[model samples]
Target: MKIRVNNDASYIRVFNATANSDKIDVYINDVLVFSDVRYREFVPYTPTFPGDYTVKVYECGNSEKLILEQELTIAGGNVGTLVITGIMPKLMLLAVFEDPNEKTCESNAKFRIAHLSPTTEPIDLTVNGVKMIDEIPFGKRTNYAEVPIGVYDFTIEESNVESEERNDGIRISKKIELKDNKIYTIYLIGDVPDIEIIQSLDIITYMNK
Candidate 1:
């Protein structure tokens, strides 16, 4: 859908996190905005005038069967993500927002985590042995935290699990590099015992248009 550029514009993107859903299409205010989005896929940020909007989701090529309908508000000059989550027959939408204008230290990178896995338990995120976020539940996200630029091991484990039992509780462990002055979000998606992560570099400049 074409939206007129204006000073009060807001930017939004869609992520398909539904583990058991078919490829889908998304409509905002009855206008087709994202189409044929498959599982684990993301639609790039699109601009829209800030206001209340009615969002509808339907299986791709079959709009007659509505999957979900929701109402959401978009504030001016902000960036956000709309995540389609949960398994079939019990789906939902999650809205996560970020302020591009939020100030941060230039020498460090800003990082956050989003828990989108429908079947996973609450999690704790540790980077290089330091706990960055503790006990974050599903369908929630953490506020940005500043970290010194460097490569580090990122680990996600079940919250409240003992270190000795980590072998069974650990969900993901991987190395990721943080670049100076960059903004990032690590999203934990999919169902438990089969969870996956998607790291995103948030570019604030792109939201201005």
Candidate 2:
């Protein structure tokens, strides 16, 4: 008789947060993973082996002009994101670990925010005039905030940029409607006065043996 053992794989997604319009190319361990990825966009997650790997980023069709590189580690049965954030000449990398085994909620929605602008100052996140996340620095992420299903106004302001007596620090504002039983990831991209906030729905499904 013969027996075999199998190991589960980890999953990773990419978020492009640069101000440049050049398409991006992402490589993992010398193998091409994502190609021609656009700025201010999020790519769907792809499966990978659980271990350490060399991650590299370059301008599409111009691999000679490499942009960013980092050594990323993935744990078995976990989910994560590889974020290419900040402006050129000072771009940065941030990895986020999401729980793969998290169950879907039926009555509420969960969301998280990531600050990726290298040139922009720290930020404060507010929803419906109420401060939600404060003093978020570049390459940092806020914990998931749960909210009831509904629509609300979302705003991001530059922290300490203006006096506390005024709201002149406002950077960007938008309206978002949350659906029940869903998860979301929002990314803040680009340089000051020209920023973009992109949102993506996150779907988690485990592979069966």
Candidate 3:
């Protein structure tokens, strides 16, 4: 099982995405499994025996009040992600099933895009002025695309925008360098105008051998 927090940690805003930004402790089946997990970070693909478990989240040193709790099932050779989201008092847990088998070569980098902005409209992604993906709605993710290691320009635009209104569309742009042999997840999050582009690297240290 893997754990991650995508809660927005942006500067002094009108309201924060999570109840607090302090580190949290994760408990599985009433036992501590992870500690001090910060925002936008994750524990990737940690192995676990197949079984049923209860996942609970609590403030670092206090277990009196649980922020979130959910039932989890770990089947043989299965991979999954436990995501924490929403603001305090309304915090929620989301589980995602992941593909365990990934065919990756050493010559290029692999990347996938995730549209996580709840209030944002579907978007079209372009790389160096070339369209890579179209009409990706919020809360959805795409399959990985392999590309040579190099710097590339990225732009995100509303999917249904008119040609004449392109200049005033909700366009977000950035440039990034992708390293070879690495896997990345580029996610769009937060509300418009204050949105953030998060590029997370997947580092696999061990696998069944």
Top candidate when judged by lDDT against the true structure:
1
Q: Which residue segments of model 3 deviate by more than 4 Å?
A: 1-22, 96-98, 160-170, 203-209
Give the TM-scores of the predictions, in the order they appear: 0.89, 0.87, 0.74
lDDT by residue (1-209, candidate 3, tens digit) is 33322222110101112324466778889998777676665654465666787888887788987887888766665544556655554556654444545545777787787776655689889999999999998767788898998888988888989869987667888897788676676777666656667776653201211
**lDDT for residue 61 in candidate 2, whole number 0-100:** 77
- Clash count, candidate 2: 0
Off-target runs (Cα >4 Å) in candidate 2 are 1-7, 163-170, 205-209
- Alpha-carbon local distance difference test for all models: 0.83, 0.75, 0.66
Q: For model 3, name the residue pairs that clash.
A: none
Q: What value does the lDDT take at residue 41 in candidate 2?
A: 67
> Which pairs of residues collide in candidate 2?
none
Q: lDDT rank, highest first?
A: 1, 2, 3
Q: What RMSD does each model have against the real structure?
A: 3.4, 4.8, 7.7
Residue 21 lDDT, candidate 2, scale 0-100: 48
